[model samples]
Target chain A: MTDRPLDPAVLTPDQARALFRAGLSVPTAGWCAGRTQANLIAVPREHAYDFLLFAQRNPKPCPVLDVTEPGAVSTRVFAGDLRTDLPAYVVYEHGEPVAEVADATEYWRDDLVAFLIGCSFTFENALLGAGVPVRHIEQGRNVPMYRTSRPCRRAGAIGGPLVVSMRPIPAEQVADAVRVTARYPSVHGAPVHVGDPSELGIADLDAPDFGDPVDVRLGEVPVFWACGVTPQAAVMASRPKFAIGHAPGHMAITDARDCDYIVP
Target chain B: MTDRPLDPAVLTPDQARALFRAGLSVPTAGWCAGRTQANLIAVPREHAYDFLLFAQRNPKPCPVLDVTEPGAVSTRVFAGDLRTDLPAYVVYEHGEPVAEVADATEYWRDDLVAFLIGCSFTFENALLGAGVPVRHIEQGRNVPMYRTSRPCRRAGAIGGPLVVSMRPIPAEQVADAVRVTARYPSVHGAPVHVGDPSELGIADLDAPDFGDPVDVRLGEVPVFWACGVTPQAAVMASRPKFAIGHAPGHMAITDARDCDYIVP
Candidate 1:
């Protein structure tokens, strides 16, 4: 397939699923523009309880979109073939990445369950639509994400520190930025912290645990929202026997729009 | 124990826990006036994922307040002893109610985990404060709840219909009612359906599945909000080996106030 900019409007859910299945589309971040893109995770049935509890305990970071039946792929909320829908899959064994593959259909097991977690892209779109500038998007860089000292309450087997993504916003538009993003609670909701990075135990703004760091110019306050990487961190810390997640930027684009997930 | 009207203002968290421990307060709805209360559910660790997914799928009805660590009694958000915090609890054995106990400490196993779900009382207080009269409260009866034809998306072993509570509000106050309740997303968020009972599959407003029927006076529309009974219905349908929940009207009073859960 050629490296052409995909138009989300013309693409059907089946077509999107097919492209993902064939590895034609890579990262789903900007592919389906207005649609709700979800973070993916597959874990053994035994750890489902702890993982779900962890998500519940830290909702802002892990806003669960839908959880599939044990060993089942079809999700009612997303309505897609999880086995072949996503473009890329990262298989983790004992909390370490073992391989990156095009599909998990080959590794399908009866004891594995899939979880679709709300991604920040949904809220980012809302911010952009409301005329609030997202620094990472403008700079053509990945959003800077940091692991904070904030500890997430532990469940049976899952627990870790909260991870947050920073977006530099002008001081004057801070309240507006909050109000716009607050409407989409299903996707990491409002700002978790505003102003200082040092307050969250970060020694430097230039270095992030994941993603690229952007410049924080004059009159800009670094606003932080809970990042989707939190569940991955929890999964790593828990070190389950088996786990699978989407590659860093690769996401599953669902039929539902960003507007559908907004509470208002 | 004497049946004395409990003063909500003067009751400390310890006093409330003690009263509940001694079975002096059977129903906690009106016991503590100014305090926030939570709906309780205790399930074996194995079913935690299903229960958490059930809450996520049915957020309007099962807004989660806090989830406890497996085998642990305290919730970080609520801050209390779960065993003695609630007035009464009903233990279910494979979907059948077997006992109503004052404290769950005896039956508490290391494999049992607890969840504190948001209750509508918080939003009801906000509505009443805004001059929107709550009919059931005025008539001295439990709020009317009904099981709709709407089916909740299945998650693991949990699946059931969406249950909602109805409140009759003057036509002019519908918007105000929505605006006030929308701020409290932790407690059922906004009205799921406004103005019509038939739209929600209720043929007669005079009869309800649970709680007492309220008078729908002239010029008043029956507005419905998802109720906390949804998880109980799901639990009954799934028939897990062991399940525990607070008896209707009996709730766990928390250290957090109603205002604490509200979004600005």
Candidate 2:
């Protein structure tokens, strides 16, 4: 752990997946520095349309990168198999997580459809490139997230509150942060709210709904962007009979460049 | 008739829709100046998933703006009814046009799902705003379009060749045309091809497959853009048992402003 760089200069995307496949269930953050990582969700074919529509309707929360064909384990960008490539997966049944597994091969079903959603890692890289300090990365912690009062636009059987990830930026640097992230819409583009925590029904900055809270320094404002974990919230609220997702902070690394998602 | 401004400075979106609803069958191109106009496609809900997937897969050819809920005639942005809003519709039965109707109410089924796709008219506005001459508009004719050799990525049962609309631009203004239209990805972004007809397998510039040809003056280059009408090609090739689409050049005008589609 001491030898590993906080941000690796460069690494092969396959190397990360290979380690995960060999049962090294470590968090994939800080590895494969310039590549795109993604959140994974697998639902039955019956609910696939609704999930796709849900992501389309609320793109800020669920900017989809690739959707695997129904019952198929292959994806467009990643050579890794969806069923067992990730380090960990959380299985959900009727809205509750039933188990966390290193590989979901045993739980795989022919009726399942998988989706790879854009992870905030891409935009965080953009922000970092612009010299904006991501407090979580600086402090070596997960980005703090909160469930907002704003309801996501509904799609068929899927709808829930929007979840947002927060990063504190120096007052003068907030605009630059927004401008940089805005370029990457496929990876949770632009901030949803800036300045107020209560507006999102968030209270007590130190206590976040998910992830460890990084300290907000004086002269800094907490900025919120729609989170990639939102689909998990939607899955929970909708209480689909069966679902599978990568455990939070444990994501699937793909063979895509982070800069490929930049719009302008 | 002489008093009516063909380019009405201020026509309410509803007024034009009312005309279409009241048995007035006419092209909508010049009627709504500042609003977003879209191409319409309706298919049975049974095949809607495949169609939606196909559009997502081939976005340059089919940039979907809004999709109606299954069995519903209303859309999110368009004020007019899908069944009667557009002045005319071409009903397709197993891939070929069976009838051109003033209204599709009689053809509408409970299982029908409608999608509104971005029309190139939006980017044409951007180009015109940037002082890039559009030869077809100046000549008062349809923009020339051709089916290209490039095949659209298949989704489910839908797959076909890419269809592109062409506009001849003064060679000197070609960069400005590209720069302006690049802002509007929803309306097929920048030109797919810039100088050569042979590159796209088009035998002659004067012989367009779909629309009336306009003159390409000397020192001008033909610019090709991904056409919204490509979905009709896919619908025809896939030969779904039933489908409905707007007649070529007849579009559904929506309440959204055209500039709203600008990506930057």
Candidate 3:
């Protein structure tokens, strides 16, 4: 309720979520240090099966961390209310953006099934911990993402192309980046493509489809990891009756630690 | 098909499936040595959302490898027909077993959705490669499975207690078994319990609820891994209108290699 800015890094996940619930709208790039963040997507129960199948088929691009039962307001990993906990939400009607709102209670439905998917932001900390430079975080810009030539396997009524986020890492540390991120399989594990953007049908590295593009630098290689934007892309392509998702970079922070997902 | 008994160890997955498709019914143990095997469960589309939610909530006991679309007969990892490829099937009506048959074609419904859950059988080969002794395979008996006291997180209409398969490992080799099996998360991951059976609310380890009992040596420790029987146990407890599952010990062999699921 005060007029001063809050420091995201030092706040607890509950504190950060409380601020968002109180109508503070901002991208959650860095919040609650080690807690995991998630991409949100809520759809009608009628379309839940198709969406679940879509995620099961396309795991790299859509690693599902948690799923809520119909009309449920919370999941196992997230304790806050789904209707008002996230900083922002995009309401979609027949796959078209109908409204962007801070609170989604007015548009929430009793039969909605919300899915909490793994976000790349969860692995960025691990990357930095391993001494791999993340260009976007260093430049204070959003990560660059692109729509690829790869088409995700269609499930029932859902389908779309794979979307990838780009991070320019030094050529010498690219393998280290892969090793670090591969440990967290639930969060966009490992880079899908390295070295060439043309192989993924991405042109003009400076012009990204979503988010701000960062410098590739002289000796850095463009490393691409599957992005969380994939399900939204699928929502647009499939044209479902109704859908809801977290606004770009405005994620739902969960209580799970980054190490919880790390595998052997 | 000839009446002569065939050696299963050297056969390809497709060859093994062909034998099953031609009415050869037997447990898939040791068949197609290096290939992955799965537990099959098919349910009506009306109940799929609940089932998918159940698997998501209880991942250890129900590690989903592949899920087929409603009315579809195959999955990405499974190329054979769901109706006739598997060796044997148990058809259920209102959760009660109505019939056991060689082919499920007559009981197959267009609205059915099939799920390929990861079985402990897939990890047994890796355990052997790591020098961990497998008593069940050595004794030519099935792995002993029991119902634990811990209840699984309930999803809509599905709820049940956790089911686990027990394996006896030498005290020195228990760590190696855990390390080796931990690499394959898709195959029920690591051990849920290491030593005490009484802690899990089981009175006697020798009297198992499913599969045959195996001996535990003087210096060996009993290790428990989440079993694939958990989902079927849920179905039987919840009593859905219709369900189909693979007969005990009979499994569906997949084309995926054991190394494909290994993590760093």
On DockQ, the leading prediction is 3
Q: What is the TM-score of each candidate against the true structure?
A: 0.90, 0.95, 0.96
lDDT of 1 at B83: 76
lDDT of 2 by residue, B59-91 (tens): 778888888899898778886788987878999
lDDT score of residue A164 within candidate 2: 90
lDDT of 1 by residue, A1-264 (tens): 435444644676667877777766365545566788888888998888778778887888988888887888877767788877887788888888788888888877898888898888787777878788888767767678899999887876788889898999999889989998888877888889998889999888899987788989899999998977788877777789888887655678887788887765
Best-to-worst DockQ order: 3, 1, 2
For candidate 1, report its TM-score: 0.90
Model 2 residue A214 lDDT? 96
Who is ahead in TM-score, 1 or 2? 2
Q: Among these predicted structures, which one has the highest TM-score?
A: 3
RMSD of each: 2.8, 2.2, 1.9
Candidate 2 chain A has its poorest 10 consecutive residues by lDDT at A1-10
lDDT for predicted candidate 3 compared with the true structure: 0.87
| Candidate 3 per-residue lDDT over residues A1-264, each given as its tens digit | 323255677888898889899998877776777999998999998999899888888889888999987899998899999899898999999989899999999999999999998999898888888999877777867778888889998988999999899999999999999999998888888989998999999988899887788998899999999988888889988999999998867889998887888886
**DockQ for candidate 3:** 0.77
Q: Model 1: per-residue lDDT, tens digit, B1-264?
A: 536444654777667777767766454555455577888888997888778878877888898888877788887756677876677778888987788887777877788778888888777777878999988878867778888888887876888888898999999999999999988888898988997788888888889887788899999999998888788777877799998888766778887788877775
Second chain TM-score for model 1: 0.90
Q: Model 3, range B72-165, lDDT digits (tens) per residue? A: 9898898889898888899999889899998999999999999999888888888988899989888878788898999999988989889898
